[model samples]
Target: MSHTVTDDRQQQTHTPVALIGLAWTLVGVPLAYGLYNTVKAASALFSG
Candidate 1:
C-alpha cells in the first residue's frame, strides 16, 4: 500500500473588505445609534 501526502500551504485568499464593512454597518451602526439615543435621553431626564 502506498500513501500520498498533499501540501495545502499555498492557498490564495482575498480579504472580504466589503463584506466586513457591510457587516459592521448593519450591526455596529444601529448599536451606536441606540447607545447615543439612550445616553441623550438619560442626560435630558437627569438635567431637566
Candidate 2:
C-alpha cells in the first residue's frame, strides 16, 4: 500500500492594487505632512 500526497491548498491571496494605493495614501498623507512641516521649520533657521 502506498500513500498519496495531494496539494489540497488554496492559491495565495493578494491585496488589490486600489486597496494598496488607498493604504499607501492613508500612510503617506501624514508622513508627507510631517516631512513638510520639518522642512518648513528647518528653512526658517537659514532664512533669518
Candidate 3:
C-alpha cells in the first residue's frame, strides 16, 4: 500500500479596477448626497 499527498493552492478571481471604481461611484455618490442632506436638515432641527 502506498499513499500520495498533493499540495495545491486554489485559484482566486478578481474584480477589475475600473469595474470596482464604477460600482463605488454608482453607490457612493447617492449615499453621500443623502447623508449631506440629512445632516443639513438635522442641523436646522437642532438650531431651533
Candidate 4:
C-alpha cells in the first residue's frame, strides 16, 4: 500500500468560530450604526 504525507506549511491553522464572530461584531456594529445615521441625516438634507 502507498501512503500520503502532508507538511505543516501546507496546512492552515484554525481560528475559533466565536472569536471570528466577536471580531466582526465589534467592527461591524459601529460601522453599520454610523452608516445608518449618516443616511438618515443626508435624507433629511435632500428631502427638505
Clash count for each candidate, listed in order shown:
0, 0, 0, 0
Worst 10 residues of 1 by lDDT: 6-15
Better of 1 and 4 by lDDT: 4
Candidate 1 residue lDDT tens string, 1-48: 999999979989887999989998999999999999999999999995
Relative to the true structure, how large is the alpha-carbon lDDT of every model? 0.95, 0.96, 0.97, 0.95
Of candidates 4 and 3, the better by TM-score: 4
Worst 10 residues of 2 by lDDT: 39-48
Who wins the lDDT comparison?
A: 3
- Per-residue lDDT over 1-48 for candidate 4, one digit per residue giving the tens place of the 0 to 100 score: 999886657667999999999999999999999999999999999996
What RMSD, rounded to one decimal, does every model reach?
3.7, 3.8, 3.0, 5.5
lDDT of 3 by residue, 1-48 (tens): 999988698888999999999999999999999999999999999997
Scanning candidate 4 in windows of ten residues, the lowest lDDT window is: 4-13
Cα deviation at 32, candidate 4, in Å, is 0.7
Candidate 4, residue 31: lDDT: 100
Candidate maximizing TM-score:
4
Whole-model alpha-carbon lDDT for candidate 2: 0.96
Quantify how close model 3 is to the true structure by its C-alpha RMSD in Å: 3.0
Model 3: CA > 4 A from native? 1-8
Q: Which stretches of model 1 miss by more than 4 angstroms? A: 1-15
Clashing pairs in 3: none
